[model samples]
Target: MFYPLKFDHKYIEKVWGGRKFENYREDMPEGKIGESWDISAHESEMSVAVNGKLAGKTLKELAEMYPQQILGKDIEIEEFPLLLKFIDAQAQLSIQVHPDDKYAEKYQGESGKNEAWYVIDADEDAYLIIGTEDCTESEFKKAVQNDQINQYVHKVKVEKGDVFFIKAGLLHAIGAGIMLAEVQQSSDTTYRVYDYGRDRGLQLSKALEVIDFQLQSGKRKGLKVCGEDYDYSYYCLNNKFALDIINIKTEYEASGEEDRFYILTAVEGQGKIIWDEQELELSETESVLIPAYCEEYKIKGNLKLMKSYVPDLEKSKSQILSVVE
Candidate 1:
């Protein structure tokens, strides 16, 4: 009864959004479309299936009805664990921070936000605000009060194919002229620290509480494992989720773990996922959910895809370590 599921996009209009998605998508509504939520189960915005027998059913509904088959035996049915999106930034985003799990649960009553970005495209001068320069809590407060926070925030140039992991408590912002795929914990709590004079409230107190001054930003170039027809790499892996990239020259084969579901997002070219005589076409910037019960599948065509899923930490570590050894 289970098959790979595709969901309708949830487009969010933002002041800093752009028309970049027009390059790959035809259904984008006319506006500054900043984010297309590809797969989500957050109470605020859940994804609805748009394919096969599951058409019109929300992600939460499917999880509730078939938790073991949809989310697998390792995940709890209380809420879906991950949020996936493609973001286009026409202007710089507000500098912000997110609370860790313990703090988020006590204050916002939600999961903490830990996110990763895989750059799909970037302009010649595109950049990102990662963390803060070495500064004490008192100095940071002073900078905010004096309208000089920019002097304390660290900036780094970005390019296509770059990867960054933004853990909770790390201040960050996406600069203009960039498009990327983001995989994050399912939460919407952001403590905005600076907004470049936008008419928005600043959550200085909370941001100060969660901002970790010691955190530094860097791109993740994962260890590569070459296959006969493809190359696979693990970008980021934590208790929250694991992010990987697969580049297929001809075709690649994989199987779904009985304990966890997998999300495959196409970042370049096009491909078809074939399994048990069924096939689904995937294009750039689109995502599909491979149900936990899916035994095996073959991705055919020349393409690059980003994969994300909840992980068994110890098992994942061993797999990576085995490669190094």
Candidate 2:
């Protein structure tokens, strides 16, 4: 009934190759020398419980082993809604854009993408490629053809604790020397317009098909934010998915309705989360799922968090659900 879900994050090549966190397994010599990456690159958010019932399986395996628990249970987690990741971009990634849900279903028969970033670390000139300035689709296509889009792409310097909400069709990329946690719709549908010619064997034709000329996410005028009590700042950004950034210090509590569950990822700081009959101390890099039933919950300790949830995937209830296929 109580088991930890595990997934494997397969490493692919990157412009700024990521460091292997597993290499520094508790190897500190009394001096906090370097960064310790605890977040794993996982494929599945293993499902161990279904509507408080013991399902005892991973989302991937369970989809097959116990499809009933997943597709037709008291609480249906049809498929993992989002892909959560912690990225330490040592180099600039490819400048790309993704389709929204409507476009996805119509063209690719897939779900669209809506992603947000919680800046963790940055350098003196770290920035983000938000969108281009006064550029039309024809101009963008011309640039893409000439392999000069990077020069035309806009950039904005970033800092820790800063948040960037990337909606579908937004032309964007994460620059080097920055690390952050990203919570996004569970779709890997990125059409890279420019990769800086990093990958030896790269493809471009497929990317052109998905790139939308009419859609452009310009520089952020302002991200939705509010005062948490009198000291900290919190923000809300939503599209296909909903994500709330709550800056916690000393004492802070979060309130939400019983619409759906929540994945509370501790992107920063040390804190204790109090839920229905349980209190947990979360380290720097840890995430826990709060059941939808626990309507009222609170968080204590000094922390900054990125919590993700599907705003309206609630009533997909089936009379019989399987834990895995």
Worst 10 residues of 2 by lDDT: 316-325
**Clash count per candidate:** 0, 23
Candidate 1 C-alpha lDDT tens digits along 1-325:
7878999999999999999999998899999999999899998778999988889999999888888898988887556799999999999999999999999999999999999999999999999999999899899899988999988999989999999999999999999999999999999999999899999899999999999999997899798999989999999999999999999999988877779899999999999998878888988998999888876889999999999999999999999999999
Every candidate's CA RMSD: 1.0, 8.3
Once fitted onto the true fold, the runs of candidate 1 whose alpha carbons sit more than 4 angstroms away are none
lDDT of 2 by residue, 9-99 (tens): 3334444645633332232233212222222222423333332333444445544454342222333555655666667677777788888
User: To one decimal, what is the Cα RMSD in angstroms of model 2 from the true structure?
Assistant: 8.3
- Per-candidate TM-scores read 0.98, 0.71
Q: In terms of TM-score, how similar is model 1 to the real structure? A: 0.98
lDDT of each: 0.92, 0.59
Model 2 residue 91 lDDT score: 74
> What is residue 24's positional error in candidate 1, in angstroms?
0.5
